[model samples]
Target: MQLSTAVERFLTAVQLEYGYSEHTLRAYQRDLAWFIDFAEETGARELADCDIELMRGWLWQRQQQGLAATTLARNVATLKSFGTWLERSRLVPGNPASRLRAPKAPRDLPRVLADEQMRRLLARVEGRGDAEHPESLRDHAVLELLYAAALRVSELCSLPITGLDAGARTVRVLGKGGKERVVPFGGPAARAIDTYLTVARPALIARAAQAASAASQSAASQSAGPQSARHDALFVGNRGGKLTPNAVYRLVARELEDEPGGGPRGPHTFRHTAATHLLNGGADLRVVQEMLGHSSLASTQVYTHVSTERLAQSYRQAHPRA
Candidate 1:
């Protein structure tokens, strides 16, 4: 089969059968397209033409173009998974990419804020501008929930109005692979979400809905489609649609723009902080795994490395004979 045809089929199978999210499908599509482009450049268009050498060459070409090792590793994984499927479907003589490998990507431990840092940051967030501004109220809740629940930005952005269990102080997150889980937060998160829902969210929703109505009439179509005048989305954007992941990133970045913690300033920083803090507070590894919505304990175990580094740092600073 043609390499491009194989990629399309693989995308369809993964999306329809395996229920991969749009984000994941798009990532695979992008990498596979890159590989197909490289293959075509080499005049090998058939899926059957892909062998270990061809696959490794493609990876090397990407490295020459300055791709990171992690990116190369992911491309390797995608290619192997695709090759396995091609074998299962009898389109290839064997899993040609089975022997392909990538450079070992360094496991950069996630950047985490200390307990004191988080407290100070949250205090600053709470006092940012007038607390009554609709956007300010929403920002406080977003940061609070992110730290409390260890939510990926996508999961947090896609939250529906019904996802919150206010009385229980828990959130129902639709995670990767479309899996759903209920994670509890602290009283602070609960309070922030409540304030947003009761006061700020409605205002932002109405403001955006009005703008959307006008824009829809002015233009026949738009990129994000015709947004409804109302929706059940928990976090509405300034444009009145659901809160987008990009907006979340900008919000968090701006909030922490001057933070001296010296690391990533996005939503995942909060996620990392939440996980590390949980581990530091003596929470069980499996429990932290479940909280982070990590499908594997290995994924959650990286925070343990972060915890160990912090412990060693503390020891060196405090020991008399260091």
Candidate 2:
């Protein structure tokens, strides 16, 4: 079958069956599109005409184009998925790409903020910002929850009001691959969210509705349906819409712009910092994995390396013996 046609079918199936997110779907589609273009360059009529050797050539071409190991690995993975799908549909006799492989990418230790740095950073945020504006309150709550729960930016933004369990101090998060996990937060996050929900959110919604009222009566009539549906969104924009991940990035960037001792100034920096701090405080690896919603312990194990590196650095600096 045509490789491009097969790619479309596979993407649609994954979208419908596995519920892949738009971000994930776009990545896979892009990888497959690259493969089809490469296959055409090699004069293959369709995916059925391509074999393991051609797959290796495609990977080699990507490497020659200066693609990183991670990109090469992703391309190999894309081909494997396509090959498996082709086999299942009887377009190919067996999964040819099961034999495919790529170079392992060099893994960098996650950048963790020092305990003192985190304390100072959060304290600065607390003292510097105005509490009256809804956007300001939302940013505060979002940052607190991001650090408290080690949340991905997408997961943080998708959170709903019902996700918070105030009594238990836990937030039920829907993570990647549509997996749901309950993660606990601290008192600071709880208080920040309480202020945003009770004071800021209602005010923001009212402000949006009032503005819409003056603009168009038709907009006002239809507003109730959408507002009712989105009422559960934990964080909202100034215009009373679901807060997006990009807005979260800008909030974090603006807050971190003047902060000291930074490796990365993005939201994931908080995630890395939180995970490393948990491990430093002797949180169990398995427990941290569950809290972070990582599918594998290996993914969670990266923090242990970060923890050990810090320990080694401290020992070297403090010990008197040469």
Candidate 3:
């Protein structure tokens, strides 16, 4: 079969058979579209026509066009997956992109909060400075669990009330690919959550009294209360709807924007900072890997590079080898 036909079939299979989400399907489509354009520009025809030289030329074309390393990596991944699908479906004899190398992604160190900054961030989350504001207390719990659990923003936002085991200090998070893992946090996260559930959540429920006024209007109203208020949502918004991940991210970004010497804070910053802190405090790499819900130890190993850099700084400053 022709390369274009095979690519279409592969994408169809990914959508229908593999059950990939819309976002992933769109990404695959984009990557493959870029590859097809590259192939047309390079005068390549069939699947068998793609070789190491052709692949190298394609990468060079992208480089000359000034594609970022991240985009290049995604492009390579898309081609590789397409090649694999072609081979599996008997459209090609073998995978042509099996040996193709992608551009190396630029290494940027993960952002971490200094101990004092962490203290301040947590204090803000706990509403230590603004105890009367229900929103403040709720915000504190959200941020605390995010840092303490090393949860991806989506995972944190999707967290269910049943996932929390307060006595065990553990939370069961459903991560990428629907994989479930248990993550543990410390006393601060626990306390923050407890205060939100006890004090802030009820006030949020009360503020949503307008929602109650609609009770007699429909069956949806008769079923509404704080317990069943947000349809089992753990975090309720000011309007009594589920708090979205985007909203959570923006809230964190807003809080961090004002902090002294804190660089480019976002939702992921908490997870990165949490992982770095764990390694610094002598936690095992494998333990961190499991906590992070990483499929491979290699993915979790990046923080070791950060750890080594810190050690090197200490040796330079504190050692007398000179």
Candidate 4:
């Protein structure tokens, strides 16, 4: 069978049989397509004819093209998964990618905002130009939950209204790999979310209702796609649509830019800062890990370096018996 025909069968099998999401299957398909294109450019025609040297050469070419270590690692992983599928389907005698070693990626520690920076950022949110604006309220809520719950951006954006428990100061998050965990927040986050839910969310939903009414009148409406627009989405776009990851990133950046002497700010910065602050406050590693929804203690341990540096700085300034 042709390489394209076999790959199509494998992808279908993975989606139908293995129950992979469309997004995951598409990503794997893209990565494998890139590999196939590269192979064809280098005079290779079939999966069975490919060798370990060809795989290494492709990786070498990617490195030469200046791909980041993390991206290269993902590419290698995609290929490995593809190879496994191919081997299972008898398209290849063995998995070539199993023997291919991924390039060592640098363990760059996540950057965290200092306590002062966090304070300043929160201050900006509180003293907004207009409290009545729903966007302002949404921004405040987004920042509060991001810092307070130590959530990943996706988790924060994907949160349904049903997951929040303002009375209990806890939120249920659907994290990576479909793991469910309850993360608690302080009074500030709870208060911010309360304000948003009461003042802002309704206004946002009102806009969504308006859009839906308008769409109902348009001639193309009947042929239009079902409103993937979730009116119940906790954080909504200005257009009353669900907030996308890009919009979340941009929102963070705009808020940071508005702050005085703002450094880098993103959704992940809050997660890193929260973890570091928790460790600095003498919270146990396991507790911090649970708060951040980290599957491994090792993943949470990086924040210890941030706390250690802070401790060393304090010791230098305060220790008298040196």
Candidate 3 local lDDT, 30-68, one digit each (tens): 877777777777777676676657767777788899889
Record all residue pairs in model 1 with backbone atoms less than 3 Å apart, i.e. clashing. Answer: none
Query: What TM-score would every model get versus the actual structure?
Result: 0.92, 0.92, 0.79, 0.86
Per-model lDDT: 0.86, 0.83, 0.80, 0.79
Clashing residue pairs for model 3: 125-140
Q: Choose the strongest candidate by lDDT.
A: 1
Over 1-322, each residue of candidate 1 has an lDDT whose tens digit, in order, gives 6888988999889889887878878889999989899999999898768888888889989999998999999899889889898889888889988888778888888889889889988888877725457888888899999999999999998888799889888889999988899999998888888888888887777776666666775555554654553677788876677889999999889867767767788999999999999999999999999988889999999999999999999999999987
Question: lDDT score, residue 173, model 4?
Answer: 87
lDDT of 2: 0.83
- Sort by lDDT, best first: 1, 2, 3, 4
**Total backbone clashes of model 3?**
1
Screening candidate 2 with a backbone cut-off below 3 angstroms (N, C-alpha, C), the clashing residue pairs are none
Q: Return the number of clashes found in candidate 1.
A: 0
lDDT of 4 by residue, 158-206 (tens): 8888888878988898886578899999998888888887888778777
* Clashes (N, CA, C under 3 Å) per candidate: 0, 0, 1, 0
Poorest stretch of ten by lDDT in candidate 3: 221-230
Q: List ranges where model 4 is wrong by over 4 Å.
A: 9-27, 129-131, 214-216, 220-231, 258-264, 312-322
Instruction: List, residue by residue over 164-213, the lDDT tens digit for candidate 2.
Output: 89889999999989999999999999988888888878887887776665
Which prediction has the highest TM-score against the true structure?
1
